[model samples]
Target: MTTYICDDPVDRRAGLDAATAAAARGELVVMPTDTVYGIGADAFNSAAVRALLAAKGRGPDMPVPVLVGSWNTIDGLVVSVPPVARKLIEAFWPGGLSLVVEHAPSLSWDLGDAKGTVMLRMPLHPVALDLLRAVGPMAVSSANRSGQPPALTSSDATAQLGDQVSVYLDGGTAPIGIASTVLDVTGPVPRVLRQGAVALDALREVAGEVIGAGQPDGA
Candidate 1:
């Protein structure tokens, strides 16, 4: 297991390189995102995804979210991006907003019992973006054990994940220090699944009339 300091350009490049290689090899890599540190694996590698869940003591029920490198990356992942979803992406992507959409049926990988849907996000962190661009989509979850606090620093991630992760890129503390707001866009109107960094009012401003999880449709 190795943890590389990413503040230095040389070290950052080395860390990203190692992370990319690790992901390609179906190994888990801990990296910092805009919200928090995440332990990531190749999204297309089922074994690696399973190992990531095992490492975190998480179950298949709470499937991992996929991180993308850029805005256009979402185009190929989902069956179709709703106009409302596009508005949300334009308003809050590369930040702390995640969207749940029906994925392409032909996708070969499994992210547990996703029910044909996938949660995707593009983090605003430079190191995370670089790694994602190199490695493609990754199945990622917060860097900590299930039911444990989220890891804010690379050291915190290492202490929790230990040897389970192959490479740890210490990209300092998370910029937002909170999770992203998750919106499910699979229905007629978008609904809020989890409220975090992005506020409901902010989302409403862009998408308009987004309902919460328990609220009836069109309420």
Candidate 2:
């Protein structure tokens, strides 16, 4: 595993360069995000996406989320963004919210078995954002085995992923130990699919009358 300590300016530059190289090689990379460490591969590269799924032992039916550098990158991926969705994006993007929307038909890449929906998020971490900006859209999911706890630190990610991933960007621990809250906005009403870093009440503030995923605590 190629590891770099991101505490220093020189190391940070090297780390980003390493991550860029890994992505260009179509190799899976584990890097820290605001919420959790994510395993990433080039989103537009079919072979890279497949390799990421295989590395994680993820099945073809489970689709991974894509992490973009900024909100501008989202428009080309999703077919349409509802007013409420746009509000949420404006309010909480680059933070800890992931929105699942209808994918644009023009998008040619396949992420396992994503059906027609694609989850998009712009993480708030500088290293993650820089890497995404350099590498473009990346097929990213929590760096952990499927059905297992998400990795909160670079050590956790390395333990779970090992050599299966080409490089592990040790950007220290993540700010949020849990995954980002997932919201589905493809329908008329915005719904919470999973509650994590972002709270239900917070989502309702922007979405107004958000429904939880059949859970008692969902807002």
Candidate number with greatest lDDT: 1
Off by over 4 Å in 1: none
For candidate 1, write residues 7-56 as lDDT tens digits: 99999999999999999999999999999999999999999999999999
In terms of TM-score, the best-performing candidate is: 1
- Models 1 onward score TM values of 0.98, 0.95
Instruction: Provide the lDDT at 68 for model 1.
Output: 96
TM-score of predicted model 2? 0.95
Instruction: Give candidate 2's error at residue 209 in angstroms.
Output: 1.9
Which pairs, if any, clash in model 2? none
Query: Number of backbone collisions per candidate, in order?
Result: 0, 0
Candidate 2, residues 14-100, lDDT tens digits: the string is 888988998998888888999999999999998999888887888779898999998889888888878898999999999999999
